[model samples]
Target: MAGTLGIGIITYNRKDTLRGVVDSILRHTSTDFEFVVADDGSTDGTPDLLRQLNVPCITGRNKGISWNRNRILWYLKEEKRCDWIIILEDDCFPTVFGWERPWIDAIERYGHVNFMPELTIEIDNDISSGRGTPEDPFIAPMHQAFCIGYHAKALSYVGYLDTRFEKYGEEHVEHTQRFLRAGYGGLSQHLSPERGQLFYLRGGLDTLPSHSHGSHELAMRNKTIHDAIRHEPLYRHPWRNDEEMFEFREEIARVLPGPAPEPEGEPQLFDSIISLGGDELVNQAIRNHFGRPGPGLFDQFIAPFHTLVSLFRHDFSGLLSTNCLYGYHDALRCRDTLLIYHNCLEKQPGEHASVEMFHAQLPLLRHRFHTMIQEIDSLCHRSRRVLFVRSWRDGFLYAGQHRPAHVASVDFQALVDALAARYPSLDFRVMFVNFGKAHATDSRMMFANTDTPDTCPRDEELAGWSRLFSTYRIGLHT
Candidate 1:
């Protein structure tokens, strides 16, 4: 009996390469299988291309490779209920006819298979060796994540790829190691046929366009995470906990609408209104105002030090970029309100250094702030109006209570002035909220302040805040 088979192609921003691979697969393959594309937030015309090809696709925000692969695994194994699943990257192409036959057979015997592409001299040498036949391929250690196959039984035992891995690197190696430790057979390799090889590597294709969104910093960070948890017990779920799992599932249910439809004539750009601050206060206010919150690139609670590092380095990969917002790109283009908050300068007992330390870092802080505003301006080019809500420093409401010593020393207004002067096209407005003694007077604010680090205004107060924002729409100010 021939078991059901599902083939998934994972793609990012490679529209031309994806089109070639999809065409190649359709022309060269003659197997009965379910096919789908897992798109990782490709802003570059890939959605329309997929619709033109009429291929079923599963898409989400620009999470890293591991998370994107999990979308395929979840859809094929859990939703489609296929007995065997084969994963291929957009850059990988099949050169031989009936290419899916050997892979299906190999998975039936070994439970998993990773095809070796003819990219390097060593791989070319291995393929020349006539060790394994087409019917039953040679067993080798799992390497290379470009093309892989997994049995449903093996998937049930192993689990989904770890989403903690940011961008690219180390995720595939860790996953394959876990598979081997679980007593499953390693990947299968075989000699090439006279017609062509089983798969063609992206490196060997010189005619196609080459584009990479990965960086050394992201790879190094992922390597550190791999080293820390490679030896731990296997994780059988995609998410960190039940809450995350349920949240992700809910997001999938809400966003995954089968294959994407062709976009209407000439995509229109909408004016963007965004809020950038430090912490969940900003997120809460946006959520309260919109009646529902969309996915934000920096929606989570971030530490003051890390936020500063992100600004200084201009690194927005990993947690800083990924969020609960499902169709992040689509939502970002249409949504009018965006809230970006961090806790870099937030005052918490023992959480920050002495005021003297902040003073010493004032120059670096100003430079980082300048870099941050420049980046924001570049990112929100579609928006004509941008608003920065400056949350008050701790103890701002209490009389005679001293604020964090860094508050008065750092000149945020100067940094904004320099950048705003350079970029004349964007309208930048800064609003400072001073809830003078409101914590003591207002019962809602009082109750909200009972929790440490919850210095944001309550949901009820957001209505008045919105009205105040509309009142100050005259010109750019600090």
Candidate 2:
């Protein structure tokens, strides 16, 4: 009466090792578990081998080890809804019949477990002193990533591997730490060979047919990222935010077969809308107006106040900030309609803009502005029409006595003119929404609560905002 179990073998370009591992598992393991091979863009006839073996495979482009492992987790824990999952590397193989029995038992008790390929006398002594028994395995300080098992509950709580680590290094270590932080027991050390046996390891740098995808340089890079974020809060998702999550899901859908069908809904006014600066308040207003579910890329993404220069500092490829990444990916997915809403009043309360700072960064800002426009033009090439709703510092900021003088100083008209002339084929239109009067009481013209600043517009206020957007006449056929 055990719950459903899933076993996934993560393989790269190691067809021979993968085949051997599959053969060994089939020959030795007697567990009735759903099994599949996850191929990480293996170029070496691995698909043919899998077909010849008639093994079900989840294949995707090479996004590195953490991504590959995440695919397995998403497939088994998220899609298949398995009660327990076991991840085995292509180089690891079973050594004895019913080797999965101990793993299943250990996972059921400890929630997370890692099986050792071979045991040394030192490990044996440690196990004996550490209350290791056939009934209860010894909990090691760390667990191997090569052969690991997790109960679905624990997996769900700990979440997927951090995809920030590329190629593979400290991702496993970071994942283990996150698991431990979640208050889950990890059983890594097993009973001695006389008591029980687990997997057999092969194919490292020292071994024949070494299939190591890791390099010292890659490890160091991953280690740097790991050390930087290890002390920070755990980021469970493979994606950074909703925008990245959407992009990643789309990427997976395109590569893997049998993607889920798109949900039925009324067509939106725009194919995609990118909100800049206004936080979720503006995003929520848009969604409420259009009957959309959630914010699209850049919708809720926030940049540091007074750091507008940072947004234009790099080309799309060089942009490394999470907000910029979200914008880039979301822009790639846009096809028909693209709307960019930029609010000038994203500064903190009582924060005043300095004219001197603007003049100091003017040269760099001009260069970056050109680059930003070029990048946007390239990214939105597929869109039939593009619209920019540029809200100037007006009644909203003036009412709160917060003057973004530097922001108001920028000639947005010239920027828009440049963009329209450069990308005439894109049918670009720029709408300047400015409430000239400071005491403009029209709820539709200004936000309801200017004091709170971050508050979302109420239903009537959202209606007013929608009406105001509609007046721009950017050709929302919907």
Candidate 3:
């Protein structure tokens, strides 16, 4: 007896296309397979459409494309409804008969195949693949995520998709990489275009960062190679329950092929691009996402070192090394090296978006911060020059308090005092530069409500830095 087969689709927002897709798959695909459609928080009538169609649906977990597909596959495998599974998008529909048969047969012989029809258009000229026939498809150097069909055991052998990556893309690419690494490389290939017909609606989404677009800052890409690489992945899942997610991850890890070999060299510490939001919620973004500054137990324990490490952002450009250092631009007076770009924090707008964006970028930002901390260690051990800069928009809190209501009030002086007490440093100064209106027009202002120190960097603040600055510790290379 033949084993069971399963089909899964992941859809978002587009309702009409989804309905048409369901209709097309039901009409074609001349084989028996259980079908499941995952809805990614479609505000449209997709939920009702799925209901009318009567296919099993994975609802409420609109985390992203990777998470949705993983949920469907997990459900099918758990229920033993499938010995083989084919994954598709809402827009990917079968235009020819035997659609599911060829895929199921291909997975058995070739391990896996990305369903595709004859290329009326060219693909091999660039990023997609080189031309090949149906009997033995071209083994392109990269992991293809489109129209993927594989044995359900592939999920058990290789790990499930990495949900940390957002819907924009890369999750599929990473999954393919891990799949290949588990000794399944030769088993996967693009379908012989001669045998399959797939219609892909050219939704301009293929150009966005979430789809097939440019690299978003720290994302790893290897278009030219077929190697599996793992950077620090973010911690994200669709389930609201933490314990459940932990248990799920543990279960998946138990079945995957062993972890990759340890990397040889030390990992990189700095990233040049920083997506920072505007002054509105920058402080909270830093504390909750990147991390807040304070004297922790180890910091207090090592107070005797009196080291200084400056947290810097934006363009210090010519100011740090050249003629621009003399307050030509108030923000540039204190020169700090370029780490992560300042604009990266601005990816999301409101609080929930803030939380989501925070999770996505936290791992990369933490690595950069850790690199800066290592430099701080060197400074405390050697020259003892500390320079830290954060564009504070949120109000300050007392040492122990986390929420705003728990603390009375804090200003620039308060921040300086907080830093001094935490660091146990030799000398500390809090300087402020006015880039906005002289006063807060309403209850909220761009900068946090604090005594705006009119005493900007001048005279010794700029001149006597040699006494405080260490040629070794500043991390400033001219």
Candidate 4:
């Protein structure tokens, strides 16, 4: 039977090379098959690159080669429901125009195969002879884990390849040999160096491990192989059913230690991201520090309700149910974090209220926020600074200078200078989001602003006003 095919590439830090190999597989393969990229804690930009490719990627903390192999194998076998899995290293490639058909044919005919098959005499005494030199093909059950396809059900006859060989060097090679020695072998084809169909990248050497531990690894794998042959390996008797195994662990401490105290003497700028499970305590904490809560769905319950309700009534006054009023009051409390704009304003501007002057000076606002974000990032010790600038009054700023009654305000410049003096060594401004008319006016607006000389003094402008006007648009999608 032409079996179901699943292909997976086990990759580490070879981001660029893996991209080439993945692209080749996607562009040149002949048949459709399930594909997954198994990554093992690649610290490079590999993870980010995988996301860009939109590939199915599974990441796990580094636990050596066997961990990666077993993870992908288990995932494919259990979750993917693939009948035959073709496991390839990130550096492998197909030589022929349509290499998948031959792969399926090989699996159908031999039960297991690799594109480049440099084989040996295997002595099973019946049909196989001495399989030699393999030294360390993979040490996993298949001997040729590099680019081999295997029938999923074959594991039923021969139990799983022992996974205890955690990178003692030729560990995988030994397991491959062991899987084969158990007699799961079938048809064999020795791939000549010249056979122009399938191949390995850069002669098939991976980008990791200095092999300085080869002898130690060889001895380790040899012992495991010997143990399995003697039926002394712990996994010798295996679970044959199709049920998924589950595991859970408990923390057995009465008083769990709290998080490590953040080091003293730094005013860090870590963005306080709120999630669904959050409560008012966090809201209050944020208000205590930052002066304003970050953009939120919670505020939508009242902010918009009041705005829309104000439109229908002659008086801009409306009553929020007590719960909402209290919530808004709580949310509006000032936070301790160095808020860019704070009570320094002699006059407190209602949240999201537009200052025609700030809006009118949109160009300067945009540039200022762009610069401040960078400075904040540097001062906050290279931490992310999310600056949110939004406006509910879409047309108010663009309404051309009926400006707010000129109210006296605290000198905003002094507050910023004070914040800088307090947190000198910090990095700031990673993402700045401009919402509603604030974004529109700052980014794409071509209209004229009559709020000239921008009547509002710099200190009186709202918090995050510059981010809305900044030339550098970072993560403004929201």
Off by over 4 Å in 2: 119-134, 187-209, 241-247, 250-478
How do all the candidates rank in terms of lDDT, highest first?
1, 2, 3, 4
Query: For model 3, what is the C-alpha lDDT against the true structure?
Result: 0.43
The candidate with the higher TM-score, 1 or 3, is 1
The best candidate by lDDT is 1
Q: Candidate 2, TM-score vs. the true structure?
A: 0.48
Q: Model 3 compared with the native: what TM-score?
A: 0.42
Give lDDT per model, in order: 0.55, 0.54, 0.43, 0.40
Q: What would the TM-scores of all predictions be?
A: 0.49, 0.48, 0.42, 0.41
Give the number of colliding residue pairs in candidate 4: 52
Q: Per-prediction count of colliding residue pairs? A: 5, 0, 22, 52
TM-score for candidate 1, residues paired by index: 0.49
Candidate 3 local Cα displacement, residue 473, angstroms:
71
Measured with C-alpha atoms, the lDDT of residue 179 in candidate 4 is 39
Clash pairs of candidate 2?
A: none
Per-residue alpha-carbon lDDT of candidate 1 for residues 339-431, written as tens digits (9 for 90 to 100): 122233334654433344444554664566556555566745645655544343322122211122123333344435543654556655543
